[model samples]
Target: MKKQIALLLSLLLAPLVSAAPAPEREKAQPSAHHVAIGLPDWARGSTIYEINVRQFSATGKFSAVTADLPRLKALGVDVLWLMPIHPIGEVNRKGPLGSYYAAQDYLGVNPEFGTEQDLRDLVNAAHAQGQRVILDWVPNHVSPDNPLTKTHPEFFWRDEQGNLTPPHGTDWTDVVQFDFRVPALLDYQADVLLHWVKNFGIDGFRCDVAWGLPTPFWNEVVRRVRAVKPDALFLAEAELPQQQVAAFNLSYGFDLHHAMNQIAQCKRSASALDEAYAKIHAHFPRGAALMVFTSSHDENSWAGTEFERMGAGYAPFAVLTFLLDGVPMIYNGQEAGLDRRLEFFQRDPIVWPAETHPTTRLYQVMTKLRREHPALHTGSPMRRLDTTDNATFYALERTAADGRRVVGLFNLTAKDAKADLFDPALAGEWRDAFTGETVKLDALVPLDLKAWRYRVLVK
Candidate 1:
C-alpha cells in the first residue's frame, strides 16, 4: 500500500515539473530580448495616424471624419492626429484656401471644418471606437489678427524695431511669433490646451514646431497639460534632444527618415540606413520614443508623396518602419496609396489611387505583422545582424521575451541576392512573416527581390 501511494505522488509531480518550463517562467527572468519592455501606461504599443481634414473627404468636416471611426479602428490605428481645426485667419492668408496654421480665433472651431457641436460629437464617436484624438497645436506662431494680438499686443515676439516678427526665417506674414520669455504667455497657452482636455476629453496634443519653443516652457506646458489629463501623450513635431527632458513621449525620427528617403531615391546605399539607425540609438536617450513614418503632413505636402520620395523602395522601407523600434504612422490616404501630393493650402483631395498603385496590400500585411508580433511592436530595439550580401541586401534581428526571435531581410536592388545568415542564439524553425513558410538558416537564403521587396522571418 505504501509503494502504490508513493507511485501516485510521483505521477502527479511529473506533469507539474514538465509544465514548469513553460513560457511564463522565461518571462519572469531578466531578459536580453529588447521586446517585452513596458511603455508608459499611456502610450505603450499604440500607433498614430495623421488626419488631413481638409482633403480627407469632399466636405472636409469633422462629422464626415467621425463616421469613418470604425474604418480607422479596423485598420489598427490607436490615435488620430487632427490638423488644426480652429478658424483660419482671412487677412494675409497664404492662398485661396489659407493655411490651417493661421488661426483667427483660438477658442472657436473652423466653420469650414465643422461646428463646435460637430467636433464634440466627433470626439465622442472616436472614443466609442477605442481611438484617441490629438489636435495639431501651433504654439510658436499665431494668426496676425488672433484674439491675443488684439487683446494684448505685448504678448507677441518683437524685433529690435519693436515690430511683431515671424518665426524662424519665413515669408509667413499671416502669423506672428510668441515670446516665451513672458510667464503670462505660457500660462495662457497652457490654459487653452487644458480647456480642450478638460471640456472635451481630448486625449493629447501633437505640438507643431516644438523645437522652436523653449525647453522650460515645454516642461511647464507638459506639467500643466498633465494636471488636467494625467496620462496625456505629447507628440512633438520637431526632433530635438531637449524634448525628451521636457517629458515628451515621442519626437520625429527625422535623421533616420532622411536617410531612408536617400536610400529610396538611389542617392545612398542600404548601408546608409544602418548608419542612420545607429545614430538614433546613440543620440536619443533611453525610454525616449521616436515617431517613425514614410509620410506625414510636412513631408507629404512640402517634399513629395511617398511614391515620389520612396519610388520602388516604398515597400521595403515601409517594412522597416513597421518592424523597427519607434511608433509607425500612416498619413491620411497613405494606406490607400494616394499618389498625388495634396496641395497644402488648397482643397486638393486624394482620389484613392490604391486600385491602380496596389500599395495598400503591402501596408496591410506590414500592419498585420506589427500587430501580431511582440518582436515588431514598441520597446523592441532592432539590431543589424552581420550579412554576407552588403550592397543590395541586409539582415536584422529582433528578439522578444519567451525566446521568440524575428529576423528581417531586405533586398533593396531589382535583382536576386543571396544572404548568409548565422545566429547561435536563434533557435527553432523560423516562419516567414509575409508568406507564412518555414525558413532554414543552415544555408544561404536566396531572395529574388523586385526592387523594394523584403522578407521578414519569425521563430
Candidate 2:
C-alpha cells in the first residue's frame, strides 16, 4: 500500500517537473538581453496623463477621449495612460456596479466601453498625433468569475480545503489573488501582456499594485514583453527604487506626492517641497524616472479630487511637478478642475465643454514651457540659492548642458514675500514666464505671491 501511494505521488509530480525545468533552465542562463537596456532619456522630460475612459466623458468611450487628444497634446502631454479597458466581473460585484480593476478576461476588451477596433483606432490615432499610449495593467488579482478561476482553479491561491481567497486587508470581495506558485499562471499572464503590445500596438504598461507580485515574476514579464517590443516602457505603480534597474522604466513618487499634499493641507510650508526633492534626488539613481502627479486614480477615488487635495497650491503644484526632474502625470479631468471624486465601481461620468478652464491653461503653459526648456528635461540637481527669509519661500536655479539657466522661486504663505537674485550665475536681465515682464537682477523681484503661486525666471 505504501509503494502504491509513492507511485501515485510520482505520477502527480512527473509532469510538473518536466514542464518547470525547460523555462527555469532557460531563465537561469544569462543572455545578451541581460544587460540593462534603459528607456529613452528623452522620456525624462515628458509628462504622463492618466485617462479613466469610462468616467472621463459623458459618452465614456474611446471616441470621447480621442476628441480631447489635441487639447491634451497642446497641454504638452507626452504619454496618455488609459485605465483598464477589459471587461469587469459580474460575480460578487461591489456597489452599484463592477470595478475596472477586477478584470474578468485578460485578452478581451470591455464591450461596454467599445469594440476592439475602437481601441486599435485609438492607439493608431495617438501614434499619429505623436503621443504614446499606455494601458493600466492589473496583474495581482482577477474577478471571481474569471474563466481562469473556473477552468484553472489550481492556478489561484487556495486554502487546505482548496477554497480560493481574496486579496488580504481590504473589502475587495470581487476579485481573487493569483497563486504565483503556479508556473503555468505566470506564462499565461506574460503571454496576455505581450499579446496587447503586439496586436493592439500599445506603447507600454502601467502595472497596478506592482509590489504585491513576486519580483522575479516581473523580471520574467518584462523580459518577455521586451523580447517582442524592444522600445516598450514599463511604469510600476509602486515607490520602491529596486523596481527601476530591472522591471520598470519608472516608479511612482509617493514621497513627493506626500510633501505636496502636506503643503496643500497646511501641515507643512512650501519649503517642504525642497525636502521632498532632496529625498528623491539622494535615494534614487540619476537615470531613474519618477512618476510625479498631484493626484492619481487611487488618490482621487479614495482620498479626494485634486482640487480638494491641493486647493490653493493646485496650480503651483502642477507647475512644480512639470518642472521637476521626473515624468509628470495628469489625471483625467484635472485640466477641467473636476471636483467630485467619481465612483470606483460605478459609471460616474465627467462633463466637458468648449470654454477654457483654469487648470487647462495652467497645464498647457507649464507643459509647453517644460518641453521647450532643456534645463527641465533631465533628472539633474538644482543648484540651491541662499534665501534670507526661508519662511514661505525656496529658490533654486537649474542649468542645462547648453548653459541655459532657469531660476525657480516659490511662495507658500498667503502674504507677499521678496527674494533678490543672489546667484551671479543666475543674475542677469530676465523675463518672468507668466507675465513676460522684463526685470533686472540688481533689484529685488517684487513678488505678490498668492497662497501657492510660483515664479519662473528665464534668462
Candidate 3:
C-alpha cells in the first residue's frame, strides 16, 4: 500500500513540480445575484456529517440511522448529508449493490434503503433534534435504465451510431452522461431538486460532481429551489473558480486536503498547509466557505482511510480541521477510526469502535469545542504564529468577532518538536481546551510536542 501510494502521488505531482509556482489565487469580481445562495442563521458556525445509510449500521436502513440521531446531535453535527437515496439500475451494474450515483429514477426511493415515508420520518426526526438533512444529488449522469433515456432522449448524448455513452474519459459504464445544452432538460431537473423540499421537507442538497456540469444549470436550480426554501444550503462536490458564485454555499477544499496528505507522508513541509489555505481563500468568491476534511467516501474507498494515509497524524489533522477556519465534516464511522477500505459498490458495513475509545472521545471533545467556541467559526480573523521548527511545527492564533481568542499548534513530522511561540497581542492567561488546566502565555512559551500531535488553547 505504501509503494502504491508513493507511485500515485509521484505521478500526480510530477507535472506540478515542473511547473512554475502558481500565481496566487485571483479575487473574484462582482457577479449577478441570480446564482447566489443565501446562508442560514443556524449554519454560520455549524459542522456537517456525511452518512451512507447503506453502511451506517448493521441493518443498512434509514431506521438504523434515525435511531442514532441523539448520538449524532451529541457529536455536535448540525446537518446530515445522506448519500443518494434513489433506486440503482440493474442493467450493467458494477456490483451486487451497484454504485449509488447510477440513479434509476430521480423521484423513486430505493427499496433496498427504505420507503419514502421512512425517509420523511428520518427527516422529521432529525429536525426534532435541531439538525438539517440534505440529499446527495447526481445531476451529471443517470443509469441507462432511467426513464429520461426513453421519455426525453434528447436530454443525453449519443455517438455516431446513435448509442448513448458513459461520461467522457472513465470506466463508469453503468451510467450515461447528460448534455447540459437542452433548456427543457435543465428545467426538468430544477423541479427534481425542489421535490424534496416541497414534499419531504429536506433542508438542501449536496450536488455531486458539480464542476462536471454547466454553471448556468446550477444558477437556475439555485434560483428555483430557494424561491420557496430560502434557507436551504448547497454543498458542491468539487471546487471551481466560478462554483462559489455558481450557487454553492460551500465546496470541497481539495487543494488543502491534498497538501495536508503530502505533508503527512513527508513529501512536503508543514508550512504547505498555510500555502494551500492562502491560495483557496484568495480565489474563492467573497464570503465563500471551504469544507476541510481528513477523510470522505472517496478517500476511504479509493486512497485509504486516514489511518493508512495519515497514520499517527490522523488525530492531529482531525483536531486541526475542528479548530481552524472553514467547516468540518465527519464521515460515517470516522469518530470510531474506521481502518478498512470500504467497498464503494457493494455491501460493506462499518464496524464502529467501542464508546470509550479514544478516537470517539477525541471527536466528542473537539466537536463540543467546535460548537461552543466563537473563535473557531468560519471567516474568523486568524494569523500564522512563528514556531521554532518552521519545517515540522505549525502554530496559529484566531480571534472571533465576539472578542474570544484561541491558539492552536501541531507537530507535523515523525520526530519530537519544540516550537517556541509568543505574541504581545495574545499575552495573557489561557485555559487548555483538552485539559482543564490554565496556563500563562504572557511570555515566549516552548511547546514540547510528540510527532503527529496537536494542542489547542481556548480562552
Candidate 4:
C-alpha cells in the first residue's frame, strides 16, 4: 500500500519534470520577404505612443487607462503600446513594484493591474477610436519562477552550479535567460505570442530586446503569428537594419536619436545626420521602417528627458522626428512636458497639467499637420537644403509627387539665428505651418528665428 501511494504521487508530478529539447522546425523558408508583411494602412502617417499603466494613473489599472483613452485620442496618437501585462515573478523581485518585463507566466494576466477582461476592454476602447494596441513581449527571458523554469529547464541556460543564469554580464537579477538553441523553446515562445493575438484581439507586438533572440526565430515567429492575424505588425526594439528582413515592420532608430543628442550638445553639425541616412540607405531593405523618438520608456527612465538632453532645442528635434522618413512616437507624459525621470519599477503617476500645456499644443498641431500633408508620409522623398550655419541651423524640404510640399528649417542654437535658405524650391509663396501666416521664401532672404525655434512652411 505504501509503494502504490508513492507511485501515484510521482505520476502526478511527472508533468512538471525538467523539459527535454524539442524537435526543430523542418522545411523553414528563407526569412526574407516570404509574404510581404508591411505596416497596416491606418498606421501610415500616424503617431504611436507608449503607455506605462502602473504610472499612467492613480488607480494603476487598465480601467484607468481606458478612461484616459479620449485624452490620448485628443492628443492625436494612433497606436498605443502597453507594457508587459503578465504577472511579475515574486521569488526574486526588483523592488516593491517589480519590473513589468519579468513575466512569471506567459498565459496569465497581472491581477495587480486588472483582469483579462479589462485588457480586452482597453483594446476594444482603443480600436473604437481607430487606434491600434500592441503588447510589449519579453521574448529573451522570463522570471526565474516561471513555470517553464522548472517544467522546461532544458529551455534555459544553467550556470556551472546548475542554477539558471541571467543574460551575461548584466545585472538583470529578476529574470533568467532562455536558451534559444533549445529548438522546443522557440515553438513555445511563438505559441505564447500567438495566444495573445488570438484571444485578446491584440493588433501587434512590440518585441523587447529582439536582438537577443536569433533572427531566424523572429522570421519563423512572424511568419507563424501572421498566419493567424494576417495584418499583424511586428516591431523590434533593436536598431540593426538587418532586422528588416527578419519580418519586422519597424525597428528603433537609435542612430537618429544619438545624432539628435549630439546636435543638442553642439558636438555634431547638421551634416552629421547625413551619415545616419547613408547607413540606412546602404543596409536597410526596401520595406523597412524606423521608429523615431526623442524619448521612450527606456530613455526616459534611464537617460535624461528630452528637455534635459535637448534643452532649448527640444521642440525642434520633436518636429524633426515627425518630419523624418519614419514613424514618430510620444512617450507617456511627454506631451505635458513631464520634466522628471519617471521611476521604472514603482507607482509614479504622471503629473498632468490642469490646463492645456504648450508641449501638448505643439503635438496637437504636428499630428494634425502630419495627417493633412501627404509630403510628411513615410517614403516621401526628402531634399537637403543649404543653411548658413550648418552647426547651429539645419533645413530640409519634403515633397510628395502630388505637389504637396513642406520646408522645415530649425535653429538649434541657444541664441536667435537668421539662416539664409538657398534652394530654388524655396523661391515660391508659402504659408507657415504653425501660425498660418503667409511668407514668400526667397533664396536670399534670411528668416529671423528665435532660439531653438523651427519654421515649417507649406505651399
Summed backbone clashes in each candidate are 0, 0, 0, 0
What residue runs in model 3 are displaced by over 4 Å at the alpha carbon? 1-38
Cα lDDT of model 3 by residue, 172-286, tens digit: 9999878776788888999998888899999999999887777667878888998989888899887775767757888888888998899889999989988987776666666
Pick by lDDT: 1 or 2, better one? 2
Off by over 4 Å in 4: 1-38
Clashing residue pairs in candidate 3 are none
Per-candidate TM-scores read 0.87, 0.89, 0.91, 0.91
Give the per-residue lDDT digits (tens) of candidate 2, residues 1-459.
Answer: 999999999888443332221112111122222333356665766788889988988888888788777877787888889999999999988876588899999999998788999899888888998888999999989998999987877677754445666775557889987777788888998999989998999989999878777667888889899888877889887765556657888888888899888877778876777787676555554466678888888899998987788777777788778667677889888888888898887789977757878778778777777778888775655676667666577666777888887787787665666755354565468888788899677544444565577888887
lDDT of 1 by residue, 4-62 (tens): 99999978744222221111111111212222212355455567889989999878889
> Which lDDT value does model 2 have at 316?
77
TM-score of predicted structure 3:
0.91
Model 1, residue 28: C-alpha shift (Å): 38
Candidate 1: clashing pairs of residues:
none
Candidate 2 C-alpha error for residue 212, in Å = 0.9
| lDDT (Cα, 0-100) at 312 in candidate 2 | 74
Q: lDDT of all the models against the reference?
A: 0.76, 0.77, 0.83, 0.83
Which residues of candidate 2, in runs, are more than 4 Å off?
1-38, 419-421, 443-448
lDDT of 4 at 92: 78
